[model samples]
Target: MVKRDGLKWWFTVAMVAACWRKGVAAEAQASAIWVMGDSLIDSGNNNFLNSWAKADYYPYGIDYYRGPSGRFTNARTFSDILGDWLEVAAPPPFSSPTTAGRRILGGVNYASAAGGILDETGQHYGARYSLNQQVVNFETTLGQLRAMMSPANVTQLLTNSIIIVGFGSNDYINNYLMPNLYASSRNYNPEAFANLLLNHYARQLQALYSLGLRKFFLAGVGPLGCIPNQLATGQAATGNCVETVNQIIGSFNDGLRRLVGQFNDGSHPGAMFVYGNTYGVFRDILNTPARYGFTVKDRACCGIGRNRGQITCLPLATPCFNRDQFVFWDAFHPTQAANVVLAQRAYSGSTTDVYPINVQQLAQMRL
Candidate 1:
C-alpha cells in the first residue's frame, strides 16, 4: 500500500510540472516582435558593440524622451512605431545591460549600426554585427527562453513572432562605392552586384527560418542616391540624385520581392514575408515633401553642408528649428516624423506600400 501511494504522489507531481511548463511556453508565443538588421533599425545595439557608427549622443535623439537612446535616427525608429500600432511595446536592445529578465518578454532588438547583409559590407565601421551574426545572437536569446519553457514552445514563440529586417544599403554606399579602398563597382556591373547581395541575403533569411522564424518583415534598400550624403559626395557632379545608383537599388528591391514570393508560394512551408515598400514610400515623400508635412527633403535636419549632410549629425551639431518640417534627421536616417509616416503605410497601406500583405495582416495570421 505504501509503494502504491508513493507512485500516485509522484504521478501527480509530474502532471503538475508538465502543466506549469506548458503555461510558460504559452505566454512566450502570444506574438512578440524580434528585430534584426542595420543601423536603420538599431535601437542602441551599437552602443554595446563599441562601434563608431553609434548615435547615442547629443542631437541624435533630441526628439526622443530619454534623448539619444542610440537609435540611428533622431527619435523612435520605424520598429518602435510599428510596435506601437500593434499595441506591443518596442523591444529593448538585446545587448543592453539594463535589458533582461521578464522585461525581455516584450522582445529584443539585435540590430547594430553599420551592419549589412554581407559580413564584409561595413568593416570600416569596426565592430558591426553582420546579418549572420545577428541570427547567432538570436540563438542566445532562444536558449534563455528555452530554459524558461519547453523547446517546442520556444519554437512556437519564434514562429509566431514578428521580425523586421532592414539591411544592404551600407553594402553599396560603404563598400562598392567607397572612394578609396573598395572597387567592387569596377569589377562587377550594378545588376551583378545586386544579385550577389540578394543571393547572400536569401541564405541569411533561410538561416532565420531554420531557427523557426516564420513571419518576416523585409525592407529593401531605400533610394540610396537621394540621401543627402550621396548627393553631397559621389553624385555631386549632377547635384541631383544619381539615377544609376537608384536603378541598382530598384533591382535589389525587385529581387528581394521575388524571393519573398518564392517563400510564400510553397518554396518554404509556413513562412510569410512582407516586403516593406521603402523604395516607393521614401521616393514618394521626397517627391512631395509637402504632402507629408515636410519642406526640406534633401537637407538633413542636423548636419552642416548644402543639405546638412556631407557629415552625419555630430556631437552638439546645430539642429533645425522644426524637425517635423524636415524628412531626414541626419545624413542617412529619416526623422521620427518621417518614420511614423512610413510605419503607418507599412502597417495598413495599399498593396503597393507593403506587398504580400501589410504588417497588420501578417500579425493577425493564424499558424
Candidate 2:
C-alpha cells in the first residue's frame, strides 16, 4: 500500500511541474511595444492637432488603400508597422479603436509633428510641441493605461514592450543647425548646435529609462542633404544631393550612435539602440534610382517647380509621372511604398549599411 501511494504522489507532482512550465513559456512568448518620436513615426494622432506639419491630407496614404484623398487615413505609419509585428508575436485584443479587433499586444504611438528633444529646438520653427512635451504626453498615456490595468500588469506590459524612437530630422532641418525660416531671432552654428541638441536628447532617454523602458530601437540621422527642399534651392548644379549638408548629417549621426552606445552601457544596461541608416539607404536608392523604378532621383515626385521644391505637393501642384517609381513623395517625406520597403529592410536585418541591428534582433533582445 505504501509503495503504491508513493508512485501516485510523484505522478501528481510531475503534472504540477509541467503545468507551471507551460504557463512560463506562454508568458515568455508574449510581448508589447511603443513608438515615440517625430513626423517619421507620427500617424493621424497629429491630424487632430492644429499643426502645419500634418500629413493626414490626401496623397499621403494614397498608395496603400488607393485614392489620393484617403492617403493619411488609410496609410500605415511606423507605429502601425510595429503594432502589426506585436500582433504576430503576442496576438492581442487592444483597447484603442485604431487597433481594435487586432491582437491585444500593448502598444501606442507618442510621436508628434515637428517634435524634438529640446523644448526650444522643437518649437524653433514656430509653435509646436517640443520633444520634452511629447515625453509628458507619453507619461499621460501611461497613466491612462495604469488606470485600466494594475501596476504589475502595466509593468509587465512595459517590460515586454520595445520602444522605437524616430526623430532628429526636424531638429536638423526646421530647428537647430540651420537657418530658421519662421523665426529670425535664433541662429544655429551647426557643430556647436548639434552638441547642445544631443545633450538634451540624452536627458529624454534617461527620463524614459526611469519609467521602466529598457529596449530602444533608435533611428539615426538620414541623408538630409538629399531632401528636395535643399536641392530645390538651386544649390546643386545638377540638382543632386547637397554634399555639405550631408556631411553635417553624417557627423550628427556618428555622435548620436556614440551617445546611444554610452547610454546602453553606463546607465541603461538593458537598452538597445537600433540605428536606421536613412542616409545610406536613400543614397543607394539615389545612386541606382532606376533600379527602384525612380525616373527622377534629383527631383521629388510631387511638388512645384521643374526641380521639385518650394512647398508640399498638392493636387494643384505638379504631380509625378509615376509615383510608384519615385523614392520621395514630396519635399521632405518618402512615399508609402518607400516607407514600406524601408520597414521591411529594418525588420529583416537586410540593411547592413544603414541598420546594423534589425527589428527582428531588437524584438528578441532580453535587455
Task: Give the lDDT of residue 185 in candidate 1.
Answer: 79
lDDT of 2 by residue, 200-281 (tens): 8888888888887776777777787787888877766556877877877676677777776676565666566667766666
lDDT of 1 at 314: 91
Question: Across residues 120-176, which tens digit of lDDT does each residue of candidate 1 receive?
Answer: 878888898888899899888877887787877787778778999988888888888
Q: Which pairs of residues have clashing backbones in candidate 1? A: 61-68
The clash tally of candidate 1 reads 1
Whole-model lDDT, model 2: 0.62
Give stretches of model 2 more than 4 Å off.
1-30, 66-74, 82-105, 122-127, 177-188, 315-318, 350-356
Backbone clashes in model 2, listed as residue pairs: 61-71, 61-72, 62-71, 92-103, 92-104, 92-105, 93-103, 93-104
Q: How high is the CA lDDT of each candidate model? A: 0.81, 0.62
What TM-score, over all chains together, does every model reach? 0.89, 0.79
Query: Could you tell me which 10 consecutive residues in candidate 1 have the lowest summed lDDT?
Result: 1-10
